[model samples]
Target: QYRLQYKMTVREELYRQIKAHLDLIGINAADELFIFDGEADAEVYNRAVKHVDLWNHNVEFLEQETPWERPAVFIEFQPIKWKAIVTGVEYRADVFANLHVVTDWNEGDGIGEFQLLEKIHEVLAGLCGSNFMEFDIDTSMTNHNHEEVVENIETYHCIGFRHLK
Candidate 1:
């Protein structure tokens, strides 16, 4: 299992409420979402995707169809904000999970780069998970060339989890 972390700046009361809900749903106090049973990396990613999807679906339904029974929009917004935070954590988890699998495929050799990319694409397609439109692996320079390296980097079709809503 992987441990994910997401930092949020919010009031203590609201944070406590959010933490309570997360706990109620089985998320840990450490903000770690566990992947049980030694599941494959792809399986873990799929589970994370499902968890977010279900939460969002329930929130949408409650907001639209049963608004009266729930807190007012303003109050509910606090939890929504926290949900977004959790979703962002999940997104990062998915990316890093794929990266770990890819890098491990060939002992981090450059030879398996293409195969790793293919595996990422396959997992994303099959799970209907967040779209990872593009990514790049840099081998040209180390941390010493930070300034020069930034110029050579490329990013495309990388949508933020916020926009997915």
Candidate 2:
């Protein structure tokens, strides 16, 4: 007898792919963003990532009690509902998530966070992976924390699909 194996769900696969992409593009803790017309420069500048991980909803960091790195990037995934596409063989879902771009407001004249946000948005928006399609930037906003850390959350939307072979 022969059998086919399924590794992960659509949501998990989508998350993995996006995380890998962000890891590849890189997020640095640099003071100034060397914005140039060349793409290679951007890639090099992004390689200075300090912290990048999936947000665990840790309130300690938000309460200004925990001491974390200056610049960080966290990915938070929203709940997804999978719908049957071809009876039971295929599934599809509308994926949504936010990229939390965090940086210290006291660093580099207090605008590096926004610059980093722009670089992240450029690299992530419209990104197409194997299982997931292009990701679109839906909205973005800034929030100031008690620790003088500024966070720019960019919400992204994408379509995820899965198939059983």
Candidate 3:
């Protein structure tokens, strides 16, 4: 299974910009916007490519968020998968790794880059799997409190498992 949490702040126009880009890429609003689940290795790679393509299209938005700010996105890939027991015996384990990408958009003298990076490291340490859960964190300006704002981040959690009896 793979999961992802994405956070970002953009002007209404920018939001429209992103939507337009998505449309241009043929990703319809009705499409499964979140939770990309797949069973095959090729499927997994395709899903990740889709997300990266979207991000590339909106790379300008990140740049606009902070003037003269170079925000680098880092993703930690963690793979996890489920196994089934058959004939009173357990079969081989299915493996996957979760992907966690964290960056700083604090835009102040609060925390150092390394410190922010460490926060994600701590979070990734707790996750285990070969099926990756990918998370994209955009810590930018917001009207809501820290916890509330963090919760608002869009997350795409996916699972790819098959058990046969």
Best by lDDT: 2
Q: Itemize residue pairs with steric clashes in candidate 1.
A: none
lDDT accuracy of residue 33 in candidate 2: 47
RMSD of 1: 20.1
Please give the RMSD of candidate 3 to the true structure. Answer: 16.7
1-32: candidate 2 lDDT, tens digit per residue? 97777677655665676665555444436545
Q: Write the per-residue lDDT of candidate 1 for residues 46-139, one digit (tens) a residue.
A: 2221111112223323325433211111111112222344553443211211111101122334443343233323333322223332322322
Ranking by lDDT: 2, 3, 1
TM-score comparison, 1 vs 2, better candidate: 2
| lDDT: the better of candidates 2 and 3 | 2
Q: lDDT per model, in order?
A: 0.26, 0.69, 0.29
The TM-score obtained by model 3 is 0.23
Which runs in model 3 stand beyond 4 Å of their true positions?
1-57, 60-111, 129-165
lDDT of 2 at 76: 88
What TM-score fits each model? 0.19, 0.74, 0.23
Better of 1 and 2 by lDDT: 2
For residue 23, model 2's alpha carbon misses the true position, in angstroms, by: 4.0
Q: How many clashing residue pairs are found in candidate 3?
A: 32
**Candidate 1 segments whose C-alpha is farther than 4 A from its true place:** 1-110, 125-165
Q: How would the candidate models be sorted by TM-score, starting from the highest?
A: 2, 3, 1
